[model samples]
Target: MKISAVVVTFNRKKLLLECLNALRNQTYPLDAIFIIDGPSTDGTPEALLECGYIKELPPKKGNWSWETKNVIYSPINNKPIKVYYVRLYKDVGGSGGFYEGVKRAYEEGYNWIWLMDDDAEPREDALEKLIRYMNLPGVIALAPTVIRPTGEISKPHRGILCFKKIFPMIQIPLDESKYKSNQPVQIDFVSFVGPLIKRDAIKIVGFPKKEFFIHHDDVEYSIRLRTVGKIYLIPDSVIIHKENIKKTSLIKKRFLGKTIYRIPYNKLWKTYYGTRNLTYLGRIYSKSKFKFYFKLLKRWAVSVGAIILFDDHKIKRIQFITSAYLDGLRGKFDNEKPKRILYGGKKE
Candidate 1:
């Protein structure tokens, strides 16, 4: 199968290099490598240029005939493997990057697209394992086991796992032995990092919603894909996540008249996206099941309380939380983009 690996990166040049090296060493041959860079001042572009493995391509054409031109441009001197970099001046966030990457993959006529973060370094045989398991019937997307820097393997939500009214921690076994075997397990959701998506799935469900910016965009996409086909977690495939884990409260709070919350400095935006998006998912599912609506409300409430009491931006956090809930109630699909912060900017 022709597989195109799409990686979206920000300012982590070192980690991005590690990830690219791992990709280059993959057991399965890569058809193409596309990197979507959010204009980095960190010399990442120069580093990528130095790598030599990547072939720089220009921005995609905006016309309808762009697909035909892309196909013609896909071949690099008749070589099957091609590499390209796209630099975006506006920071559309990770979701935007993903959407662009997937669209490019499809335009290039790749049968499968492997999505990864700049920090995700897969095991040597990760792609091979996923490709082998993807041959199973009805499997549309396959994810590898995610490992932390501490050598602990992160687990995905599998089998009938349900959240209570409040988004309480759902504990499961972290033992690697449970997942060491070469078995394909069914899952309700899987992270976008290091997953192989069949082109057919993308055609059926479409790319993730770019408006989500970064958070539950994956969840929303996966759930919709599930309707057309199943998503699987292949235990034998593994990838290491090289980023630091930042904890942010999953709730929003309303205080005074304005929304107050810390703009995710490093990786805290994931928390905001997760909380807000999950609330939206709960409401979406609640249309048929009343319990899901109540469960979503309960979780949103708990999240708000957590932010108000624990998060540093208590008042702003409350405002964000309230806004999210009210928006969800009103079926708001687009999340308002947070104001950009300038260096030495004015405080709210």
Candidate 2:
């Protein structure tokens, strides 16, 4: 079966090179590799050319037009792999990058699409492992176990998004036992890190929501995917997630018998998108309208309380949190407002 790999990247040039090299060394070679660059300013485009990943950078068309360049990477005794480099004039975020990448690969008639980020480097056997189970009945997608550089599994990427309780949603990641077992484990959610998805599944649930811009888009897509068929976690297939470590500390205090902690603001823009997207997901998923609004209020109350109690830049944080929550409730997909808050522009 023909399979293509889609890698979404931003400004992480060094990490992106490492990831591409890993793909080059895969035991089961892919028919094509699609590089979706999020208009990185750190000379990522030039670096891709320097490494011979692309012959030349395509000229800019327009803000929404992503230009593409194609090349064939022919190894000594191995089959040549087609490389498609798409450089966007706009920063469409990870969600948008994948949406475009998958759409391109699917439209090319690839039977399967392997999805990942520039920060993820799959083990040489990763694709081979997943392909071994491609013919399994009722399986729509299979993903590798995401591990850290330290060789520990990154738990959040593979898990069950539990709705056992109406008020709170819990994500229960695969336990150590499940990872150790030889059997494939059925899961409710998997990230875009290293998942091999069937074209049929894409035709059904459709590409990820580009409107999400960034956070939780995978989760939202996973919810839709689970409706059509099964998503499995292949324990043997592995990929290293080299995401930049965010340096932030927790504000904690002993209250009653437990320690109440608040996460410090690392990037307020990320907080805005995450809050807004999550709130939007709640609105669409909830069966009861009253319950959705009630949850939204509770979410805002908690966020406002945390900003007041622990975080610095109270006014700025409160403004972003309040605006994001409201925009989410209204089902608005705005890029400018969040950018204005993150950079140094006044609220619009």
- The candidate scoring highest on TM-score is 2
User: Lowest lDDT 10-mer window, candidate 2?
Assistant: 162-171
- Each candidate structure's TM-score, on Cα atoms with residue i matched to residue i, is 0.77, 0.89
Top lDDT prediction, candidate number? 2
Q: Residues 217-315, candidate 1, lDDT per residue (tens digit)? A: 776777777888887888878899876755353344456765545444333333445555666665555344566666656766786776655566565
Taking all chains together, the TM-score of candidate 1 against the true structure is 0.77
Compared with the true structure, what per-residue lDDT tens digits does model 2 show for residues 1-348?
898899999999999999999988888888889999888889998998899888777675665655555656535238678888888888788999999999999998999999999999999889989998987889999999999999998998999876432234435676777898797889988998999999999998899999988988898889989999999999999999987665345567665678776655554676677778877777777667687677778878987886786678788788888999888778899876865764565432
lDDT of each: 0.68, 0.83
